[model samples]
Target chain A: MKNIVIGQYIPGKGLFYRMDPRTKIISVITLMIAIFLLGSIPQLLVAFSVCAVMMWVGNIPVKRVIRGMKPLIILLLFTFFFQIFFNKEGKLLLDEVMHVTVVSVLGIVLWTIIWRLLARIGKFKTVLLLAYIMGIFVLFRFLPFGYSFTTFRFAIYEKGIEMSIFVIIRLVIIISLSTVLTLTTKPTDLTQGLESLMRPLKIIGIRSEDFALIISISLRYIPTILDEAFKIMAAQASRGADFAEGKLKDKVKQVISLLVPMFIIAFKRSEDLADAMESRNFVPGKPRTRIHELRFGWTDIGVGVFTLAALALTIVLKVIG
Target chain B: MSYIEVKDLSFSYTGKRMILKDISLSIEKGEWVAILGHNGSGKSTLAKAMVGLLEPNQGTIAYDGVVLTNDTAYDIRKKVGIVFQNPDNQFVGVTVRDDIAFGMENLMVPQKQMLEMIDFYSEKVGMKDFLDKEPSTLSGGQKQRVAIAGILAMQTQVIIFDEATSMLDPYARRDLIEYIQKLNQEGITVIMITHDINEAMYANRLVILKDGTIFSDGDKWSLFKQPEIFENSHLELPFSLKLAAALDDSLPEEKAVKDFLWQSISNT
Candidate 1:
């Protein structure tokens, strides 16, 4: 009945939940911004290390955190493919197809190393999780690790330094921090924070209350929708519906059978909500009472000031560079 | 004055097939009423119409001498909050606390008072620990408890449970019924629509609707004098009541069929 698992939360008295939802939101955005603004190797090194430490503090499971990157697998390949021939230093994996720019032996080595480092520690940090996915990789068969592009194109040895372990440690930080914010704070508080953050947009007649309603409703119902889908899949599976062995066209028809029950449940839920709301005399108005109070305190200010100082120092370092 | 006066009410889903056909029911204030019939028997439609969620095609519904319409329905609604059949459908907030807070937020209660009320009602329904948890993760009974907490926090004068305990297991259902009984004792008017005849046994008034019309309406004790009522109305006697008939040969018991059955069965 009510016991439905959507995105399961790990109950913990960790620092993540102890922090206010608004504070968590602000810190997440700030850290993400810092990760993007960083350019130099030392800055990336520092930023990535900080993320690593935060991940360790949050106590999130490392593999589960890494597995979150399953969707971004294609993006990594695109990064590799785009930079490969253009590096113009590594051994040519293949001759330029239809006059595509050719890679020298040195190009591939530098591209691999730089891509591995940046994509793992960079804004979209999924490479740390996917380091071991062995598809048909375009390896530089002629470049050496210590040698630069200038030296590698003319060389013949296939020696290379393995991708670093620090990258996974780096990713564990980003995903763990994400879990810190989302898994600990309830969705209502998350929207309350967003509503407060977007208060300036109210001048344009975009009411945060209405926006919060949309968010809370979706947050509340999407899991139910997914659960409904799962239930239908199980029900049909029990009924000997041939979802598993069917051809593509037959499978599509089988999946469509699920749409009927899902929509019925959805409409029924909506109707019930409307009835409950009407009975409660629910009216749209100002001065709404929230169960959880979103507070800003000394700790929030301290966290904010610390992050602000980091931002300022990052700017200064960038200027010096 | 009739607490709820429905006069010549008629309705259809798409203007073709009428769900309620010129039905009229007068439920006096402080009355605990059970609207009962098989599925698609217009019992739920009447409940919806009573709360102003559904517009009857004809006639009028008035509460405490005030007509129920969109213009005045808002005020009437404050006096009535419904607990739906499926515990899942009525819950609307992200967390148990937030879900209960939805109606309060809509009602626009002050923040401090809202927090107090949330704590009070959550504890009232024994969901004090689940305030921070999502509704999806709670058991069906707990979800219904949260749903009850939400309506209870609203403090409406009339509460309708539309098969609200169907999803709950037996033990939780008993507890929920006891909760409702306590609310009714506190002078809150409760209306329940149920197919479960046992649930109806607990109601003060049972209004049997057969094919969009009231087949029988009266106190629960007196209604069972005619055993044939259930035969024609698509209802069966509660298991307790049926068991009471089986024990008629052995010992003296209350004339109330359900009580007799339960007593005789338990005495054994």
Candidate 2:
């Protein structure tokens, strides 16, 4: 199955579903900048509220959004504890005798920050668009980057750690944006947008139709593969195959057995695809009419403007704060 | 030139088993030839070899006097296409539209032509509503319909049905046979591999195989006249033909004997 569902996109006339993928993508970039640039409490709160409103407008169930947080619960808790106990720079919300022991404080802060940030990165990719953005704010307190001990510990202060942190944060924002785009737009519609967006690249001798066909096929292949995987699993179960009951070696062997059948099916499909393609007389450099043409209505213009505004605000906040 | 000519063709599979030994056959333009044999009799192997899917160990295969080579095999494929037995294995596209478009793509058909051809062939197969439907959503018969449409859309003069209708239920099989007969009437050379003697009866020509050898090659009447041929090839005669033979003891010179037996059975 594909990393994303293809034509399996939900069909509806909902407002969020009709927006351009490009605009949605740009909006994601705007959110990323805003997340990174916000260093103060007011800015972070504003970012959090914006994500929350978007989630409501998109009609996604809030419970499902929060359910995605299950994978990062530990990281979230760590970050919150780190921020409370170690980040002495922040205001003290609690106090106790011997509570602020230097070793414990440092370890807790380091571990908490690392886990919190890791949670955001993981949730951004795992959660849907609005859910991912909400996750960024909700998971902010669980940074796992800090230490979690009450005693002496070894630590490294290097550029590698710094880069890794930034990389994870960037991945979250990018994933969140793509999540929104995929959830709201149909794959076919997205392909058209991709084609149009790449139209300018024709001057450099790139044909967009070929690219569009590849994308559309890939998207279509995803759901089919997933369905095939489930079928294979069921077939294996019926034959007394077990995935969870095996030891490490047995699991590896079991997975290998599964791959054999899957590979056979995939190769057979590729051959058929080649034959089908040959028979259909599909040639490069041929013009074809799209039955479903994407048009920019006034709503698109409004969305574009809103996206640009969001982007401008994000940049200004980053520079100012 | 004949539609397709294979002179003294011979092939062998693994273990030095001779399959299609010295198999010389020529199919004229617009002639429907039915090849009949039991399983492992090399009938399907011969059919595949003729379509350029399998290479001949000895002997040349030609279409319209053009030799079959790597570069020229494609041209032969354009003039001829094979529909395999399994419908699921025959399809490449997830959707009917894509599958039909697939054939046209290989021939380098322009996008506009591909669309028109896809519509034309899908309609030909009577799958208008299923154009956008996924291949899995179709029934076995419907998938065959799509497969046939894929070949026909390619406009191949010679189409080989390699047990194409074997997987379908009786009703669907009957309909598919009728559809194929219609294509034969419309001047498309059809070659079908089947053990069904009744289905092969519709062909103007028949070749019966036994143990990788042609046991009987002639008109349907001649082939049926030799009961030994059916015994050796593991085939059963159609009921009417068998009844006609049984009545030959009383009416030795009866004309239209099959018709007489049919009338008797229906009246009974």
Candidate 3:
């Protein structure tokens, strides 16, 4: 449970860390738009280099940044595969027919069994498994199993390969850019930034501070609620209620056993919280002062202007193409 | 006028039975009072009533001569603060620093003053280094300290601790009791609501509640002299007193017994 990193913020003293959270949020959004607007390889390289430099200058650990991307591996691969298979423009690179015969089938089965065993030993590293799978297919082509049971065509084109790489890089850049925003800004500051951004909604009679408070309170209670949920689960388990080992209908019943108590606890907690808030002199919709005031310095203005410029340039690039 | 005055206080919640009934109490400035009771004894309700968190069905609570009504409750809250039982439920800020600043912010204190108060009170609570720490990462005790820090930053004249240490471990409870004692020593009025006779021992005055009424109100010595009061409230006598009673059947070596009594009670 402690390993959840969706809202993780690492304290640091760097350019991005020092920038105003509002500025960082606006800049990250603009940069992401620019990244998606990138069309040619040169434009992609420029955007990639800028993100690399930002990461380097921000002093963010590269290992942690890569770890943050682990959850995206499947989505990235899906995008890569979809582009490669669906795209058919540009010159043909390779086209071949492969046979599925007795010996070839034997080799394929043997390769799969060996690969699975080795993958387990290797901790199932994605790149290693992929390479091993590709190597076996290439090796089987040389086995010369001419008594064919079936055959399938395998082809690759220039545009397909180029499109896959471009799209994958775009996705990576967008992810890393947003990661930089969340990693540098503390959760409090993030919500405060959101409040500042939503200030315009005041014209419509919406109080931004209330919205920010709701978000922050939700973030604060998520872990505490989860902790209670786990305790409730353990208590139910002690009473012969098996949540993990149960039939479909039984699982639903067990889940309700957990949910009912949780809902009660949550409602009671809210009541207590309201009482506490009132005791602390908190009045809703009342003006309040903050200890950590967000000040827009010259550097913030500079960053804001730079991001705007980048967004404009991307717009121009898109128009030209 | 007394520092805090609650007169003829009777309260119930939404057509429910009376939780507190016709309770009148007055606390002097700089006094430490313990309102002791068992689980449904209405001591907690009395605490909330005193702070204007709950309006009485038929009575008036006044602080520094101003009676608390709907219009003046907000103003009175500025002078009195409460540290509730559940630490997680009371925490309004994401971090310790912000939590400490919460009360001051509500009063629209200047940013500069709020910063200074956060620093001073957080240090007073010994949570200076945990200013950036989130509430979830902190222990139940640490969260309570942050809560106290928030109240202290408000600079309230009277602090009502509503069983503040009930949920904490023994060590944490002891630490918090010492801190509260120090606060009382510094001229702040303290009203601690608890069922622990041992905790009530630290207060200069003890008010026992039973069945939604004041059973006894006096010093600990008087309360101890009346053994029935303890039994009626379901509060346990300190082990030393029970031991001394078993040994000789009469109070002996008055000073020695008192010293030993406090020592044993604190140890637990």
Candidate 4:
């Protein structure tokens, strides 16, 4: 659970860290829009280079950034497969029909047994697994046995691969840019930036300050709530709840028990928090000053202008192309 | 007028079950008062009422002559602060420095003054080194100390500890009690609500509550003299107090009780 690092701010001293949060946030949005606007591979390479530079200049650890993308691996894979299977443009890479029969079924089963044994034989299991999947695809394309009427055709188009790479790169760039912003900016500054950026919404009757306050408070409590939930889980486990080792029905009952206690604790906590807040003289809707004021210096201006220029250049090039 | 005055205070959560009943208490400026009670004995409820967190169903609570009503609750709160049990729950900020600044921000203290107060009070509570650390990362004792620092930054005349150290270990509890004692000695009124009679011994005055009412309110020495009151209130006598009572001989004092115990153990 501690590995879940969404919205976490890592302290650092770098260009992105020193820049005002509003600048970082606006720049990230602009960069993301620019990435989406890129039409050709060259433009994407440029965008990727810009993100790489930002990551480097921010002193963000490359390994940690990749770890941040761990949760998106499944989504990236899904998009990759969806684009590859459904897309039907550009030159064809493979087109073949293969038949399946009792002999082929038995052969495939035997092959799978061998593949499983091979998978366990070495440290390169991932490589072996990929090779096995490719082998199965190859067998489906070329292997011939059984009735022709039941034959299956498998094809791969060049455009499918290009499209998949494009989409995946776009997603990676967007996610990494946002991660950079969160990594560089503290949660309080982020909230303050959002509040100030959305201050104009006050004319439309939206309380952005209050909204920012709620978001900041919820972000602060996420880890604390998770810690409490784990404690409750442990306590229930000590009482023989058997959350880990149980039938589906019993596991669900155990989960419900945990949730009930969590909800009760949360409600009680919110009540206590209300009392604490009130005792400290916190009045909702009243203007409160902060100790650290957000100031937009020359660096913020430079970064803001640079991002806007990049966004405009992308839009113009995309239009011309 | 006393520093804090609560007269004929009564509170009922559902208008059916009374949590506090006809409670009247007053504390002088710079006095340290400890409220001791068993579980569900309404001591916490009383603390809340004193801090303007809960509205009493009847009676009035005044701080520095300002009545704690709906209209004046905010003003009254500015003069009073509370450190509740469950250190994690009361934390309103993401970091220790932010939590300490929370009250100052609410009071609209200027940025310069807020920073100075945060530095002074955090150092006073011995949490200057932990200003950047998250509240979750701090120990229970450290969190309570941060809470105290936050209250101290508010510069309130009276600070109430609503069993704040109950969740801490013995060492942390003693460390917190020492901080609270230091704060009291600095002319801040301290109201400590706890179930630990040993902890209550640190206070100059002790108030014992039983079943939603004040059972006894007097000096600590007078309260320790009556072991039956301790039993009736479901509060344990400290080791020295219990030994003194069992032996049917008055002990010299709390400090002497330990020396006497050591001598007796050696003699035996």
Q: Best candidate per DockQ, number?
A: 3
Residue A185 in candidate 4, Cα distance off native in Å = 3.2
Q: Pick the candidate with the highest TM-score.
A: 4
Model 3 lDDT tens row, A233-294:
98878887787786899998888888999999999999999999988888999889887899
lDDT per prediction?
0.73, 0.69, 0.85, 0.84
lDDT of each residue in B1-268, candidate 1, tens digit only: 6888889999888998888888878887777898889988898898888888898899899888899888988777777878888877778877887788878877777778888888999998889998988767888888888887887787787888888898889998998888888888888898999998888877878989888877888887678767788879979987665666555554444446556465664442
List of chain B TM-scores, one per candidate:
0.90, 0.92, 0.92, 0.92
Q: State, as a TM-score between 0 and 1, how close model 3 is to the true structure.
A: 0.87
Clash count per candidate: 15, 45, 0, 0
Task: Put down candidate 1 lDDT per residue, A125-232, tens digits, no spaces.
Answer: 554434423211334333234533442332221111011223333344455557556666665677888887887888887788779877878778887788888888
Worst 10 residues of 3 chain A by lDDT: A1-10
CAPRI-style class, candidate 2:
acceptable
lDDT tens readout by residue for model 2, B92-140:
6657887776676666677777788888878877897899877656777
Where is model 2 chain B poorest over a 10-residue stretch in terms of lDDT?
B259-268
Native-referenced Cα lDDT, model 2: 0.69
- Candidate 4's TM-score: 0.88
* Clashes in predicted model 3: 0
Instruction: Report i-RMS for every model.
Output: 2.6, 5.5, 1.3, 1.5
* DockQ per candidate: 0.55, 0.23, 0.70, 0.63
What's the C-alpha lDDT at position A56 in model 3?
93
